[model samples]
Target: YSLSVAYQPSDDLNLYGRYATGYRSGGFNGEMFGSNPFFEEKVNSWELGVKSNLLDGRVRANASVYGYVWEDIQTAKIETDNGTATSGLVNAGEADRWGGELELMGAVSDSMVVGFNYSYINGDFEEFPDLCGVDPTIPCLDGTANAVRSNSPGNQYSAFTDITLARLGNGEISAFINVAYSEATPENALWSNLVANDVFPRENPAQIMDQRTLVDAQIAWRDIAIGDGMLTVTLWGKNLLDDDYPNYSINFGALNFITEQYGDPATYGVDFTYEF
Candidate 1:
């Protein structure tokens, strides 16, 4: 269910607020428990935001703040059960999350434009018990809980700019550049290798991967004539600087491992499109 309200304070400014509720159905983890299903999860959220035009419509800005709470959050874990590795999903407990975002764009000149955006989020575990342990006689709540939520990054920011380089006969050529960055976060609640060894585990806050930054750019020419049709061509490259960062990492006493899930390597390509 959802509800929203909006107000136009001025001809160039707008404000809004919203409230909503959502849910996710439970599912089973075939890797560890073929038929046992976790409980469904639900969330309630609220948001308030504002949008405005400044500098006589040449500049635009928007910002918003939001918060939410989750009940019966489903979390997954990998463990060793009787010397066999297994993965399973469980209703870990509850969590509270909050965040905000900001964006600004400006037409600095007739031929160039710039934009900036930033966002931040924070999540906390209310109650989560370890269901997988070495001692079968001990209760699940005996020193088996977590404070931090997995995969929750605290902050991120990005910026982009586009410039019209030149104009050709009945066509125009433009170039653009964009850059993005993300804060580091925990890859998982427990280190995989330790859990696989049948030992009770706790996530180490100090053991974190480094942050990431990526850059990309593109140039294009459009509205060229091909007989009675129009043609456009574009040249582009992503992750242009080839910055290397670990998307996943683990420390296993003697061995350190990292997986580069930063996506494909730096690549450049040209595209052609025609319209009649």
Candidate 2:
């Protein structure tokens, strides 16, 4: 797909808009067993919005909304394992999803910047019914015995501020910090990959709304000269709060043969590079 942004000047306002086209292969809601493959979900989208550089670019803001349609969307389908009701992938039927967003970026001073952004999304199947032996209220996924990870949220948000710390010692050092947070989204909107609250039956699935908070920082020294180039060292870390959380769920997938290796220990790494 192609995406582009343009700004023009009118007597009363600064006009801004974005034009783009994109396509995605139908996301597989369940797994494909043996040699039998399934169909995919596809979408076509279009959108437009505007922004204003009010107060001489000191205060800038923008807003936009978009809509899309999916054809023959993949929905809940069934699979059998060893002549038994096992896990598998199926079309979610057909559907449509649409949403809109708003944002504002303002500069209160040469050293300070503030911003805010929000979005709302809504997606649903036009003809999604329960598969045989499955409940519409449960999410049916592949693997993990029975996991109910399904339909996700369409709402999102953000707000932030940044300050450029004044340079220090020969006016060469710079430092900055950022903070962000958001709402939890179910795997999608179905509360399950195929059906709401239903699991794939290879693993144990839980009803969870995935959301979390994060804070990060950086302190570095730069410009110390080596024999041939500048030497710079940076100390950085993520999820620094050491908050315990699930990074992702395993649904057997293509790696189902490796179930015995599921609960591996956490990881830590270190590196040193010299540019010459």
Candidate 3:
């Protein structure tokens, strides 16, 4: 169930609030032999926000703050017996999360526009008692420790600009560029514990996703008349700075190894399109 309300105080400004309830069905853990089924999860959320158009509609800005109560959160973990590892899902427990975001965009002139966005989030286990530590021999169900929520980054930011570079014969040349940054995140229970200092002496850095900044840009010429059609040509690049960072990882505790996958390297390409 969900409810939301919005009030427009002026032609250019609005305020809103919302509340929602969510549910997820339970499922069995197929990977762990004879493993019990994990129960469903639930969440209750609330949010308040505002939106505005400023400077005669040349600029726009929006901001929001939100909180959530998550119950019976389903999480996955690896279990090892006699050096053989198996992964399965479990209902780790409840958690609380709060976050906020801000977005701003404005037209500096008739041919140029710029925008920025930022978000922050903090989440912690509210009732996670059965959390495993670095030792694989200790059964997760038998352990009692608080852990941070997995895959939750504390902060992120991005900025971009669009510019009309020139006017060509029957066409316009434009360019766009964007840069994004993400804070490091934990992968699972053990990794989360390391971040919370529940487990001392960091075992391996591979268990945590690394923070990184990436840049991407593209330029295009559009509306060129070509025999019975309009053509567009574009050149683009991604990860322009070639920043290296781990995007995903898996920790095999008893196996004493962690596997990681990295973000893509710098890439460049060209695109062509035609419209009749």
RMSD, one per candidate, in order: 3.2, 7.3, 4.6
lDDT of 3 at 117: 98
Taken over the whole model, the C-alpha lDDT of each candidate is 0.76, 0.51, 0.81
Scanning candidate 3 in windows of ten residues, the lowest lDDT window is: 192-201
lDDT of 1 by residue, 1-276 (tens): 999999998989999999999999987778657788898999999999999999899999999999999888777654444455556777767778899999999998999999999999987776666543455564443212444655767888899999999988878999999999988887665433334444344333334555778899999998999899999999999889887766654444323433335456788999999999
- Candidate 3: tens digits of C-alpha lDDT, residues 69-138: 9998887656555556677777767888999999999999999999999999987787764544556664
Error of 3 at 158 (Å): 0.5
Rank ordering of all candidates by lDDT, starting from the highest: 3, 1, 2
Task: Please list all clashing residue pairs in model 3, or write none if there are none.
Answer: none
Better of 2 and 3 by lDDT: 3
Global CA lDDT of candidate 1, please? 0.76
Question: Which of the predicted structures, 1 or 2, would earn the higher lDDT when compared with the native?
Answer: 1
Winning model by TM-score: 3
Which of the two, 1 or 3, has more TM-score?
3
Candidate 2: regions farther than 4 A off: 1-7, 11-22, 25-32, 74-89, 134-152, 169-171, 188-206, 221-232, 250-276
Candidate 2 weakest ten by summed lDDT: 255-264
What TM-score does model 1 achieve against the real structure?
Answer: 0.86
Q: After superposition, how far is residue 111 of candidate 1 from its true place, in Å?
A: 0.8
